[model samples]
Target: MFCRILRRPGVLLNQASARSLNRAIFTRSYPFLHGGPSIDKKTAQKITVNWLYHDGKTRPVSAYVGQTLLQVAHAHKIELEGACEGVCACSTCHTIFTDPVYDSLPYPSEDEEDMLDLAYGLEPTSRLGCQVTLTEEMDGVEVRIPQATRNFYVDGHVPQPH
Candidate 1:
């Protein structure tokens, strides 16, 4: 097995290098933010979103009408992870939509359902961010990033060992 020491403390040496490689590949492949429906700034409209971050911070952001939640998050540099690049291939972008907004959104596709099944904090209101496109109706919606999705290295919350 490949192994080495890392200058940083608290991170497992093995995981440090592996995580670095994965993050490189992951960030490089996050194409959802760039390529999407064209938006005209002058014509573009915005919606207010109350973002409940994983570390328990609530923030308000303006989002575009034609972009997915994941795209909005990435645009604002929100910490949500979309490992599958908004293709619905993974549940890394799992999020919760509060109240009437959750009911207003369309039903999840089979692919999204399957992915959400693997999510850490699955709830009735849970939906993958990649699958939920923002719309004018979603204005003032509350979107939450589950704490269950915290990354030990980044979020500073380590998971209990199984």
Candidate 2:
């Protein structure tokens, strides 16, 4: 009966559901099925970020997939001055990537590039930390915060003390 059911068209069985069905059908039978490719176990990828502060302290952090670099920094209480609050209007959150993994990040938008132009100490790897999203491919990424951004302002107004 189980073989007949499995032989029918378009029958999909996930691991959990398959195990449940197997247990119900054959009470003392080992839950093992032949045929079909083995499922690959998923491995969580890690991203290593180094926050280089103006005071010469290097804080290392680990981030998982789908987290923005800014989010990671903020979670660790790292001082990355985002004067425009990550709206891409100010260059206060500017940072440079020291690792080759910088190239793995997506290209910046016109707005982010425009903001970076206003940032001091703009290097080839310069980017707005808020705009960089962490991916599995971005492992071991190193970023350095510039000293000039510690006191940045937006529209001539300073951000209030946090």
Candidate 3:
């Protein structure tokens, strides 16, 4: 099972390198004022997201405030098992917030709470990764994906043993 998951192409393309490229492009295109409080132009705030996978790999990704955690993971091509494509239906997107700062995010909706109940490895800090959006206050947030979700499931299609 682990081999099958790891076999996915381009799964481990150094996420930090990609993020740096993105940051460089962003900073060059839009340089914000270095000085304090009298802002005429919009300033971009950086939020650090640590995506922890079942294989003990922790990927740190940088995102702007107001971006969803799901969006950030997708951009970095991190192998988060989003079986429902972030639609809040499947528990495959379940994750636990390793960083306490995740508490700063707005409370999850009823649907999110319901879906989380179906997730494996439920814990006090468990949440649906897709449902968590990044806010300025949630800078430096860290989340972990449960091992159970690493495999993809296709209806009536069983994956062969590697």
Model number with the top TM-score: 1
- Highest-lDDT candidate: 1
- For model 3, the superposed segments whose C-alpha errors exceed 4 Å read 1-44, 150-152, 155-162
Q: What is the TM-score of each candidate against the true structure?
A: 0.70, 0.61, 0.60
After superposition, the stretches of candidate 1 with alpha carbons farther than 4 Å from their true spots are 1-34, 150-162
lDDT by residue for model 2 (54-128), tens? 788888997766666665676676777776555565677788886476576788976677667778888898999
User: What is the C-alpha lDDT profile of model 1 across 1-162, one tens digit per residue?
Assistant: 122334346655445344444443444544445555677767878888889977778999998788788878877777778766666656778899776788899999766776677789899999999889888888888899988662323555322211
Please, what is the whole-model Cα lDDT of each candidate in the order they appear?
Answer: 0.72, 0.66, 0.61
In model 1, how large is the Cα lDDT of residue 43?
A: 85
- Summing lDDT over every window of 10 consecutive residues in candidate 1, give the lowest-scoring window: 153-162
lDDT of 3 by residue, 60-150 (tens): 8887776556556766776565655555655666778754654665688766766666677888788876677667777666777777763
Clashing pairs for model 1 are: none
**Which scores higher on lDDT, 2 or 3?**
2
On lDDT, the stronger of 1 and 3 is 1
State the local distance difference test value for candidate 3. 0.61
* Backbone clashes in model 3, listed as residue pairs: none
In candidate 2, stretches whose alpha carbon ends up further than 4 angstroms from where it belongs are 1-46, 150-162
